[model samples]
Target: MSLVSQLKTLATRVGTEIKGLVRPDHPGLARAWVNFGYVGSAIQISSSHNVAGVARLAAGRYRVTFSTPFADTNYCWLAFARSNTNSNTQRMAIIRATTDTKTSAYVEVICATATGSLADTTEFNLMVFR
Candidate 1:
């Protein structure tokens, strides 16, 4: 084969190898992240687990329903975002309930202070990762 032809073939193989090395989302690899939470008014989901129900367990405590249980009680990590981002000093905690079958979240300072509190918010979203 011509010297030029051999060089071209070698270049093509190197380029292909480089492309494969740089592609992080290659089909053979599993995703590095997964969605496991929801935005609610009527309630919507973003996880592999299915939503079975939702309810207010108490004054400032809430529950989210998952049809199937999580692999481990401590595996879930959760966060929240309120629709009103104008201002706030309040905070929320979305965590796995002590009871495995029951999922709950705690919101502090709910309707406590008019400013920077849950009293001024309309909607919220939850984000979970395992």
Candidate 2:
């Protein structure tokens, strides 16, 4: 093949590899993610990818359902939260593994106040990886 043809073939292979790396089902990409918060006592999802829905079970507890289920219950997850209250308290977001499944997971947001109470946060973000 001519030099130009060889270069063209190499470029096409590179482009195909890059597209595979960024596919939605790529292993390096998050399987599901959601950004949610409360709006006047109701849970509101601000943005999401592969997340079907979010439900508030209690004060700081929530259930996040995925649009596509994982192969098993071996996925990893991350959570972050920030309170809306004007206080200097620290906050923590935790995933409840006991309630985790191929289709959904649970999260709880807690505040580091005197009571170490579970509280609704102004913003909550969750991500899942398989």
Candidate 3:
């Protein structure tokens, strides 16, 4: 190869090596740098209906509430389902985000009453980020 071509190849190889060294499989990190928690809820109901308004649980709800940090954004996901059913009752399933002073987004899971006749106590699983 010509001298100029050989020099170009060497510079490319050196750049690649430097990048590899900068990013290892795992860098040493202190445990304090990681934050984690859980939030959830449970509720009971006697009839079929949709609950209105948002309740601010320990872990926030996922509906598009004014308080939802992700309400204005399109990058949020909601996962919920009813776990039990009978002739006299149905449960509401809900998932949402948790907000702090910084309003960081987190996941929450819960089941509530769809009808006013039933009662539900919600327990959420919360997780704080790194």
Candidate 4:
């Protein structure tokens, strides 16, 4: 390729990459650049997270698969779940998320009501930072 043409192509690629790294507009995620969330039955990774994918392990539990796994168990991450419009109450506050110590391949988020019952398809969001 001509030198001018090569430079133009490199600039375009860099611009596109910078745009893709922008984070979601969530206050809680200010410190955590990674962002992924579920909307009803669908799960999607925001531009910031750059994750591999997400899967519903159960009603309230989700497995977030990462494109690049964290370096270790000490990786900082957060998870939160909210009840859908059909099911809203204080119980949603009891939702919780956690990861295992053996590996950083994936983080599992489990959401439950205060009564200890799994919330049905609850909306959940997760963020991780190394």
Tens digits of per-residue lDDT for model 4, 1-130: 9999999999999999866776554333433333445565676555555467777677666666777766676666666665555554532423343342224777666667767776643345566765
Ranking, TM-score, top scorer first: 2, 4, 1, 3
- Candidate 1 has a TM-score of 0.38
Give candidate 3's error at residue 3 in angstroms: 56
lDDT, candidate 2, equals 0.72
Least accurate stretch of 10 residues (summed lDDT) in model 4?
Answer: 93-102
Error of 3 at 94 (Å): 4.7
Per-residue alpha-carbon lDDT of model 1 for 5-52, expressed as tens digits?
Answer: 999999999999988796754544322222222334333334433445
Candidate 3 worst ten-residue window by lDDT: 29-38
- Model 4 TM-score, 2 decimals: 0.55
Report every candidate's CA lDDT.
Answer: 0.42, 0.72, 0.35, 0.59
RMSD values for the candidates in order, in angstroms, are 8.7, 4.9, 14.7, 8.8
Residue 29's lDDT within candidate 4 is 45
Sort all candidates by lDDT, best to worst. 2, 4, 1, 3
Candidate 3 lands at a TM-score of: 0.24
Give me the candidate number with maximum TM-score.
Answer: 2
Per-candidate TM vs. native?
Answer: 0.38, 0.71, 0.24, 0.55
lDDT of 2 by residue, 8-116 (tens): 9999999999987798767788888889986799989999998878888778777787777666767787888876766666556754545533343433333223356
